[model samples]
Target: MQSTSNYLWLLKDILGQGATASVYKARRKQTGDHNAVKVFNHVSYLRPYEVQMREFDMLRKLNHKNIVKLLAVEEVGSTKQKVLVMEYCAGGSLLNVLEESENAFGLSESEFLIVLQSVVGGMNQLRENGVVHRDIKPGNIMRVVGEDGQSVYKLTDFGAARELEDDEQFMSLYGTEEYLHPDMYERAVLRKPQNKKYGVTVDLWSIGVTFYQTATGSLPFIPYGGPRKNKEMMHKITTEKPEGTIAGVQHRDCGPVEWSKELPITCRLSEGLKFLLVPILANILEADQAKCWGFDQFFAETNDILHRSVIHIFSLQQATVHKVYVHSYNTINVLMDAIFRQTGVPAVEQEFMYEGYYLELDLAQQVHLVPKTTEERPIILVSKEQKAPIGITYKEPDVPTFPPMFDLISDANLAKIVTCAVHQLLRITKSIMKCQDFILRGVYWMLAILKEECRKTLQRAATLNLKLDFCKSTMMRIQKIYGPHSRMNQSDGGDVHMKLQLTVHFLATISQNVQNSQKQLDQIAAQWSNTNDIHHKDSTIGKVEVLLEKVSAIHQQLKKDRMRMKLQYNDEQIHKFEKLNMGIHAKKVLALVREDCEQKYKKLLTCVKDWMRIACDIRKQLRSFGEQCESLHCDLENCEAYLNNMFHQIPLKLEGDQSTTKSTASTVYPDQKCMEMAIRMKQLKQEMEHVTKELQQNNMIIQSLSDGQKPQGV
Candidate 1:
């Protein structure tokens, strides 16, 4: 891994044409050992010589077992092409390996590790030098056959590697067909080809593609196909996930060839390998570069893996060290643009005003969206999944008086906002009702996630026959605090509503796993549940038994209230309220909004609208109440009659008691405390006055009858 001459020349005799460059089998000539010489074409795009020179400079500096050594760069007068000497691989590229796997690679964990470790490790070395490999894939990664017939992998072809000395978000298009990052695709579409510029982290994406094909023997994304055709395949890699692994098992056709069959999966690799590879590959292939791991992060992860300190991500995060949760959150709305069906924004004839953010729509756009009545439009949530940690916003090269455009959010940072907001709302509210409701939604969603996901996660804490309370008295606090008040325990509406949303989110996520586990169980439920039906000869049944054991352990964990206090703090609902300042106006409208200033009043409304846009819920009773009010306004007599019937048959439920509802439906913050209660009390008094008139009529009839009936009785 020492620096070589500025340029290199390969012997012309060994040169052979390749998809990219002229490749040849050569040697250092000094040592006369076999080495590969790669020469680039420089005329059309980059001076081919410059690209080779860049790679030479990088490879010569990069030193790692997982990476091939760049022994020397051949320099000759008036070079026809650039030649770089590298360790020649006798085993050849992984592409050769895949083409040879007619049935499947049938690779074991040890074998797959030989590839992944080499790929990740080599990339790690490049990153250590601030060099970001812009392309990582099967064609670029070659495997060398060792003396004992073992394959040692080597990463080559750094034509697109970028040296990032400072933090820079990738903003251009670069890489092979299926290996480009999401940002690259978007930028390519958005800008002119000449204008589009990309960054070095694109290498991570290519690496992800390579890993996918290396691990699964199929690209997570389809290669050589355009974006549309490969979307489904790409979508799965970016969003949908399977068991965080694949090994040992053979697959059979379930439905069709296009629809992959139930392939045999091997649970062979140390679970650590899957944990490290799956998430990283997923992020690397993220539909949005901003949402995926950048080179810096990729380097850190590979370094960690090289050291063999990879713990299950789920468990490791649970440890109290509390490193910021930096998972990618993409803008799903952007990816689903093809299907979300564009609703054209209408032009405002008159410039309209909003509290926080203003609107800018056109007449044509409005007409386009008009067919879809605004009343029943499908709500869109700002996907938390489609975004990456903003970290701290990059300080501008030059300071200006203009305001900043982005607000960064992380768990540590969010904790400050949440804790402060909770304390403020708690102090401001007369009855902790509003504050409790706010707190409930956040906690509920967290618990819901726990129920849905945490429960379903396959990670476990067990060893030495130690029954460490995976979840202690702390997680069970919900039952303790509101256990008696839970709906199952005759809980009130407030708790029930929050719990439902929280539970729904978790349940929805968990349901997928439930379906998966159930399907797996159902597939083998016949065999395992009944020993008589068990067949030792059937490997599928045996595999199912092993799956059942793992699933059962997971099921037990899911059933347990095992998620940490985070189930209370870190959920979408809570995040919406505290960090985003959601429903603060509901919790205390009077305090948050100013009645006198219409501008300030409108601002509160805008905030609420934004929150609702995220698809939060409101109480049903509130909806019915509005409908009843409208009916009364339409026909007083009919309304009064109906109310009388309702009064006799069913008492109106308390709004606060009926559900844990955020006032998402309302944008304008109603006056709170004295003003809001005073208005409501006034309306009730007027209703009482009207009822008194009806009672008076009845009073008169009874009195008159009593007077006349008294004489008749005598």
Candidate 2:
């Protein structure tokens, strides 16, 4: 007998009944649209039907494709059987698709991604509406093919969801057996304390199972024969891993490949799907819900694993450590006390030693300054009526107390201080001794380690002005070889170069911190830069005395290392080697500089001297050539007079001894001789032209070499 209906009359279409609920295929009479209706026996549940009906209202309001819409609800007569009529899927649920693929025992990697996006989208919407669907599974998912050939997944049923609290706490339990979180399973089986409260992480567990099925096509845990029988079989499903004894079955031992010989159903999935899931998967699954994680924790833990994996993959880029025996302060005497009866290295336990010691010291010292339960010793109240007036009520003066011997300056604090100093000194000593390294950073091997150590100590330990002498020397070493043609110091170029500026900054920051600490001391030691002023403003000589003692201790350690150096190896030998090294270093630099300087100086000096001498010699050559030209002009005139006299004499002889044709003979003689002379004149002109060409060529030769200057002449 169904009592009320959200829709006017759709409840009459009951088509079937199952072990848990009744189902029907109904048509919305108003729109002629088909839908599936489910009737639940909400009568015997802890929550009332109204709670589920309200969730149905929320679903009905949503209009996303990937969400199942609750169209209407019908409530049964007083027994409170609630009914939900929801949108119908044509092809069926994703569970059927997984069972029907070609190689399709499971969804392929690509198909899984599409389905995952849909599922996550629906859940994200639910979350935005301030809800957590405590139950999520393949059965809860319905897939429909769109006209666009795309597969759509819809999430349904939020009966057990809870709204989160302001304090970030959520608790809920409702889902199918295979997808139920370990936390909810505990809540079902155990009475109370055994089932701890959990949060949205429960939804994540279901999501993990969903992803596993989506990828590999099968549930990681499938104990059959209904939820109760499955619950019995869960001891194996949840607790017993396929690997080994139950000790640490949840956490697998990593190997080179880090894959198990037997694969999880998820492992059988495609590689692309595995990649999509890995960044979000928490490495270990635990029955203890507290150890499980929400999304952020899942991301953090996965990132940590991924980072370590990268370091292992590219081990060459990361820092390498050797298995050397470095001395630690774990004394055998301190190891005898066991906090619990366990067997392991007591390193974390040893930390408690310092904590306990400091705590005890604090308690003891505070007792001296501040009283605790004074009546346990003695109590006498002064009365005004008896011995004295109220202001002077004490008849007898009480004894004044002074600080105890060790209370003034604690050895534990001093020890802590000394331990730090010892480690720091050891670092510097190692750096200083490796002079052959001459790397600017104390010792190059310890460079990164020391810098990080100093940074932590200064920043975390509140230490000021640690020694940076080694860092300074390291920079100088770099500066010494900074020029061209300098030999490389380290194999890795400038990356690890420990840039001098960075080193200086580290040292300078340290120095500033030290100066600041000194100012803090000045608060006590104000106006007392020198000794003998022991007023309230200045530190007492006694305190100064203790500081001097610590300084002396540091000095003593340095002296001991020096002696150790000598006794272990001869001082003279080390001194000689150091001197020889320094000399070789200076000599190499000097030789390179000297050679370069000498060559350049000689070249420049020679060029200058040659130019000076050539300047004067050029003037003298010009004067001499001018004089030669004048003498050649005079010789040419004398030659012309001799040729004229010869011509006149020859004509007179021809006139006296020849036939009576004197004028004609003269004309004929003149023509014959002139022709002969014309031949000779042509020859002379050729000779003059040849000589002129020779002169021009000589002048060009002089002009070319004239640019080349002469050395100073004698």
Candidate 3:
């Protein structure tokens, strides 16, 4: 045990030990506050005096939340050697966290994000101060619990850190072997003769290795034994770019890289996050420094990710998982609002639970906590209205049943059963074809009717528009002759002019609707035609039938031969013939035929089911189209009625001098035409809304069917 003037350190309370110094947990005498004290051995002082003070100076110069803070410089009472006291991180080192059983595959995504933000912040600060941390690894990063009960990682152990500009070069190698740059590794680990100089980008390589390990719990590049035991192979794996190699990971010496462009299966990060993270790792871990990303670009991308919304999985009481995008600083209420927008559920009636504990709105203000969950352990959302035990349930889609396999009792019986199945399938296929033909003819007939209706409606709308235009011209002439004060202009002419404008607008809308409906009908017809032609040929069933016929003929011949042999030989001779394995050979042939027939039957059944589904879908679409046609027909009738009323409301004769000026509007436009057009427009809108709702429902049905086709595990 050792004691200082203001602090006491016990030998057994050591926090960490390195080659030059041993860090021990210390307590301040006055306040009893715990702090970490770094006591250096005599050998550490033997280095250049400038080297001895580098870490202290660097720590003092840098001031950032992610960088550990230096409290005070102290001296050991017994040794009289210099020591440094810093803030104590209760959560210990990141290496310790990685060693835990849960993180054996790697840190969870939430934990990894904390590490990413912390390390990036610390490195950005270092860059601002023109400092490069050559040793950036898990062991040198410490985890501290913040005031909000969240993990905050901080950079520690600045022994290998130094002030170096981006363009400047450093020859002295400093880093862990696995994380060292290839150029530095050659000189440091391999002890090879080289005069290569490294720049600030060397730190990027270390950061890459550190991050790769943190995300996947393993290094990117490795050898047959290890990076240390097989130094030559590790250097080759890191430097050489063979045709099949990826990120310098090979299955064996001189072998191709084992990984594709994806992360290892052991990685715990989601596929979406992995997509964003892999490029960063690839650029930083480049053996050729020229290709590596600059610090500015690196920081920009990482910060962009940090600031963007994070996706989290949430389940509604053990139902399917829903992905919710929320920012890390967003509160639980914000998450609930997002859920409500996606699921149409009120936030107030929902409760969230995480890891078997109720996640309160006040405590879980940061959405970053939600990323720790997964599909299996998603944030369970309980509805206050439903009172049921929480449990996950999966419903598998119903698979179609096929004809059962025939028992191979005798060659004749097996052949007979296969032939029967083939005949049955052929009949079913023929019936399906007949149904398809009937439906196709019906669709074509309906299409012809709709096309004629659409053309007639368009022509009627055009005729009405022309009459409305002539009425407008007449109204203008009336106004010009009446000096804007005549009773015709004030009372009847003004109303007639307004009605003409409304009628024109409605005519244009009706034309547009007809055109749109025509286009939709064409598309539906094309889709149905394509689906109907999908299984136009029954070639698969025909093949099965042909094969069964051959097997049946062979069985008949074999039966004849057996009868002939029985007639030619005695009972004792027949027994000897049975012992010759001829019966076994015939049975084998029947078994083979049975297997082939079963497979063909299954395939045929699947095809039939698919065709039936397509037919049903076509029927539904046709039904919807028919309803739309009826709506259009009603719209046309209303327009005709509105035009007739308009014609009656206006008078054709002008009893004054205006009779001399040929009136264009005449009695074709009426005073009630505007109100009638408005009513018609409102009705058309309601009908369109109904059609849209029906389409939406159909789309939902299609989506459900598609989901049912996917594997249950998915």
> Which candidate comes out best when scored by lDDT?
3
Give the lDDT of residue 79 in candidate 2: 52
Model 3: residue 564 alpha-carbon error in angstroms: 85
Better lDDT candidate (1, 2): 2
lDDT per residue for candidate 3 within 502-546, as digits (tens), equals: 666666666776787678667756765664565354354455445
Alpha carbon lDDT of each predicted model? 0.41, 0.42, 0.64
lDDT tens digits, residues 1-714, model 2? Answer: 233443323456564444346666665656766677777653425456566555666676566778888766766556556667788886566776665422223465446656767776776676666666777877678877889987878876655555653225555456766677766775655323463566666777787667666655555554444335546455455644443211111122221112232224323342223433554543324455565555556544433322221000000011111011111232322221221111122323221111112112231232222122111111111111111111100011111122223221232233323333333232222222221111111112122322333344333212111112322333233334233333334432243244434444544554465445434334322212221121122222233234334444533443444454433345444433433333333333333323542233233234323322332233233334334334432432343233234323433443453334444555768777656555755764565465446445543443343344332321
TM-score of each model, in listed order: 0.36, 0.36, 0.51
lDDT of 2: 0.42
Which regions of candidate 2 deviate over 4 angstroms?
Answer: 1-20, 42-46, 49-54, 60-63, 74-82, 101-104, 165-172, 189-195, 222-233, 236-269, 283-291, 296-714
Error of 3 at 268 (Å): 1.8
lDDT for 150 in candidate 2 is: 79
Which residue runs does candidate 1 get wrong by more than 4 Å?
A: 1-20, 27-32, 42-52, 75-80, 102-106, 147-149, 169-173, 186-200, 222-276, 294-714
Error of 1 at 690 (Å): 99
lDDT tens per residue, model 1, 1-714? 211244233455443454456667754535556667766554423545555467667777888887777866664345544456777777777777754412133245557767767777776677678877766777777888888988888877776665675365455344665666645644443332444345665666677667666665555533225345544334343333333222111222221113222222322233335545566665565545456677668767765655542111110001100011112231222213311221111111112111112223342242223112111121111222111111111111111121122222333333333333333222222112222222223222322332333222322101100111111111233233334555423533344335334433443443344445434334332332232122122232233233334333332332232332234434434333332332222223323322322232233234323332221122122233334334422333332343344333221332452222225312344334436645655765565465456445544543444344332322
Best by TM-score: 3
